[model samples]
Target: MRYYLNTQTDPAFNLAAEEYLLKSTNEDCCMLWRNHNTIVVGRNQNTLSQINPEFVQKHDIKVVRRITGGGAVYHDLGNINFTFIKVGEQTKKIDFSAYTRPILEYLNQVSVPARLDGRNDLTVDGLKISGNAQHIHKDRVLHHGTLLFDVNLEMLATVLLVNPEKYRDKAVQSIRSRVTNIRKYLLDHPTVEQFMEDLGRYMQKAYQAVLTRFSDDDLKQINDLAQKRYRQWDWNFGDSPAYDFSRSIRTPGGTIDIRMKVKEGTIQRIRIFGDFFGIDPVSDMEKRLTGCRHDHQSIKKILNAVDIERYIKDVTVDQLLHCMF
Candidate 1:
């Protein structure tokens, strides 16, 4: 098997490279990568429902969907991602222990007592430190997972906060686990770079893995894929399923009730109802927001450019944005 250590931190480019290597490359491979302040959601997840919109926008975190069906994961420079693409029949590929063996072995070598608990989680003393997921193809499999070494636990907890009571849908929900950083358990905690280096050496010895570098042509292909798919709003967020959302907020102007049906991450219908007054009904303003993305900045820009005062009297742009997001 070949091994790669990706130095790029752009979430879209890294994710696109994963897919490129998975479907295009013929060799069995193992790769280690990292992303900066990113939320890689599952392919089938409702992106809006899985994230704390305010926190995400406040921190400028990127939300990118992955090609696997698992819960969302928060990644930063402190997190290490590992992927294994193998050529094998997937009919009996449900088990994840074989894939997790190397990680567990490495942990044991470092004197960290870790075990594979439940289906695919790697836990240290019963608290999860890794979450694994796999996707199967005709004769190949893509198994990937996250290793939380020194991730910001505060962001991990705060960023994924969603009021589950607000939306009732058939979308798969994420199961929150009690997570801990691997650095917390190590006596001499290694830096992320050092950890990756040690793991790479171990894998090289175990699998006789050869280190391969991407050529200019390979990166161009990956970047093109990134721009076309991973970096696009249509693929990352617009691909989410339809859902109803309503937020009632008390602003200085008035109590605003914002409700909308979002499909493919665009507002399908929107209604702004409040005890406010305007010369004209808020119909025009609502119509304007129909095709806007459900994100805070996207909708806020639209509201900022329009004469919101003309549509809804006394409702400031900030107030409308608060209710919309």
Candidate 2:
């Protein structure tokens, strides 16, 4: 029922903070705040398939994974990330809506006029402003969410998974149009710092406890854990069970078909059957992908950074990526 507040904005430190809280003492819960521009992928999501590789690389953005189940999201200095850690005891049941109530109340105090729209999303005027996910271990439950306040919507659009026709058809409105931010409703009345202070006060009031500050020892312990597990290829990309996936890609070289079986998020099997002429040794190309992380960034990094020129000629990395994913 206690709270631990982290004001650090570094993605690695923020991630570490969460892991530290999760594994430390279980009963005393804590809430941490992260303010920065970063992209966080879910535990089971494919980093490459879920993100725009070129855009992320060009912007020098850092990518990290959370120990939760959900889609990817973009966080920046304009956004606020919160993590609520509590031991789930029989006396105090863990209710998703109950936990989110405080957030709704806080937003209302700020005149954002937002409401929970779905099981895990908060929307204003029918556009989503926050998304949340959860992780449970033993008697502890961690529910974390992001609050979008004037975040860079353009960067969000660029880095997140592009809305395909199939996904759009599932909803009454397009997914892109259904998401919005508090800035759209703020009218430049409150600055970011004021809002953050107000939010901190609101949380302190809601929890009825003085904020607990984490120390360097706390951050270092958490960072070490996050780096080993959350940022690793096996955990982030290989978390998913083996599945067969096939995609058609268009490249400057030509159209190609990529089919592969992913096991534990790694490329266990693959075949590149395409019309594009092989300017290099295709066998070596297939070998390159095998045992590599099935996620886009890992695969692209291996393909682009490797000295593949010895085997292939006049073939760009994009063409290779187009053929694989």
Candidate 3:
């Protein structure tokens, strides 16, 4: 097996690298990496429903969707991420234990008392320390997971917090879990970098893996992939499952209610209802929004170009955007 320590902190690049290594290469590989403040959603999840949009925007958190089936997860520099791509028999069944065993063993050797508690979670004293997911392509199985070395638990909770009542969809929802950082369980609290180094060294020795680096060609391809797909809003947010959204807000104008059906990230239908006074019919504004992308910037552009106050009295563009999103 080849071992790689990816030092890049960009979430999109890291995710794209995973795909490149899984599909573009045939070698059995293991990688240890990290990402900056970001939220990675599962492929089948509704991106809007899985994240706190206001908080994410305020903090400038990058949101990307991974090609895996599982719950959404938060990532930061303090966290450690691992990926294992192995070529296996096509008839082999998916096994969580097999992929997670090395992680559990590494944690136990370090006196963390970590154990595989459920299907795909690694827990320490009943609190989750890691969450894992997998993607299988033909004869190759890509298994990746996160290790909470010293992640910001507060930020993770705040960014992932969502109003469940706002969206009605069939998309898979993440199950919130009680989590703790591994640094807290260690006798001598080590920095996340040190922890990552120790873990990588252990894996190298355990598997007799060759430590390698990405060639310039490999990086160019990964960066190209990131720009083409991982950084695009269409793949990250537009690919979400179709859903119905409704939000009501009280403003200086009055109580405004916005309801819409979104498919392929485009608003297929929309209706605006409010007790505010207006000279023009609100139906006209709804018609303009029917074909717009269900995105903050897209809707804001349309709202700014029109005389929004004519349809909803005393409501500023920002206030109306709050209701629409």
Highest TM-score, which number?
3
Candidate 2 local lDDT, 63-133, one digit each (tens): 77777777788888888777777765433343567667888998887678888886788888878888887
What lDDT, from 0 to 1, does candidate 2 have?
A: 0.70
After TM-score superposition, the amount by which residue 60's alpha carbon in candidate 1 deviates from its true location, in angstroms, is: 1.9
Between prediction 1 and prediction 2, the one with superior lDDT is 1
Model 3, stretches more than 4 Å misplaced?
Answer: none
Please provide TM-scores, in order, for all candidate models, with all chains considered together.
0.94, 0.82, 0.98
Model 1 over residues 256-279: C-alpha lDDT tens digits? 888898888889899988877778
Candidate 1: segments with Cα more than 4 A from true spot = 90-93
Q: Write down the lDDT of every candidate, Cα atoms only.
A: 0.87, 0.70, 0.93
lDDT of 3 by residue, 74-107 (tens): 9999899999999764745667888899999999
Look at candidate 3 and give me any clashing residue pairs.
none
As a TM-score, model 2 comes out at: 0.82
On lDDT, the candidate that comes out on top is 3
